[model samples]
Target: MDQVNIEHTPPAVVEYLALRQIAGLSPMSREGAEIGLPNSLFAVCLREEDMLVGMGRVIGDGGCFFQVVDIAVHPDEQGKGYGKLIMSEIMKYLKENVPARALVSLLADVPADRLYAPFGFEYTSPKSEGMWWRQGE
Candidate 1:
């Protein structure tokens, strides 16, 4: 596997979202607008041969807390640590860019939680449970 070519930019972000949609992690249309890139997201993207391979994003409040969202890698490119590479960069950014005491959270997808464990993330459960009330649910 080739080393991941990571970047934070419009094109890279669009690529990331497209790959995430393909991975079934993102809504198919995003309200009929793919303006995710160069719009408001800050992304850590991995690309090869103009192909979007992997990426992760930080979304939500600019301060206080942020959700680690949309981490995805193309199926053909999953075993090469590309997702880890994207995650590592996102974590690094949170550590360096966000305030020291700010909270960062992610909805881990099963085995993927193990990847975040090494980054000092732990279960909030057994202490405090997670709850959500989506707009329509």
Candidate 2:
């Protein structure tokens, strides 16, 4: 996968949201309609000739913390460093805008944590924990 173009589009924010809905792992979907919208979070996608190959984003409170969510690369594009690309882009944004020691977090899914670790994302184990609020009963 050579020559991937990463675009930070304001109007295309919905792409990341839609992809998350497809991935079906984030709290946004479980949180229901009032909570999740097209642009509630900041998003970025990797495109190779107009096709969305990968994406990730930072969501949550601007003052206290942020969650790195929606990290996904299309099935056909996986194992090609696309995941790292997405992580790098998202981390870059956080580094530039977030204040020092502002607690940037992400819920790693199994082996995916390997990619995130090198980007300075540590497991919140021993000192802390990670949990979620699921929807419905």
Candidate 3:
């Protein structure tokens, strides 16, 4: 495989939504992407030629709390270490920007959690659970 280009840049709304679909992730609305991407504390985009193939972002208050989100890679590009490359860039940002006691978290979808373990993520399990508020529930 040829070298993949990874950069500290966020994807546009169209590319962001498309990558989510390709990666089997939940869809984000156009307005959501428009508002959200700019607010990211750190973001990385992987490209092969002119195509956006992978992306990840860190979002949260600048201090005390941060969450790793939107980690996705194109289906055709899966198993190629792009996810780890994305995470490494995000982790680098966290290591430099977040304070020692600040909380960093992510909602790992099943097996993907394994990819994060080496970066020091652990299950919050019985001590504390991860939760989200749905639109109606």
TM-score of each: 0.82, 0.79, 0.95
lDDT of 2 by residue, 41-125 (tens): 5667788888777887677787578888768887777889998888777878887878776878888888777988899878778
* Residues 1-137 of candidate 1: C-alpha lDDT, one tens digit per residue: 69657787534444555776787774534442355444444677678967777777787677888888778888888789887787788878787778878888888878778888888889998998877764441
Supply the TM-score for candidate 3.
0.95
Q: What global local distance difference test value does model 2 have?
A: 0.72
Q: Give the TM-score of candidate 2.
A: 0.79
Cα-lDDT of candidate 3: 0.91
Q: Which stretches of candidate 1 lie over 4 Å from their true place?
A: 10-17, 26-28, 32-41, 135-137
What is the Å distance of residue 104 in model 1 from its true position? 0.5
Sort order, lDDT high to low? 3, 1, 2
Q: Which residue pairs does candidate 2 place in steric collision?
A: none
How far is 11's C-alpha from truth in model 3 (Å)? 0.4
Count of residue pairs whose backbone atoms collide, per candidate: 0, 0, 0
Clashing pairs in 1: none
Supply the global lDDT for candidate 1: 0.72
Q: Write the per-residue lDDT of candidate 3 for residues 44-124, one digit (tens) a residue.
A: 999999899899999999899999999998989889898899999999899999997999999999888899999899999
CA RMSD (A), model 2:
3.2
lDDT of 1 at 17: 51
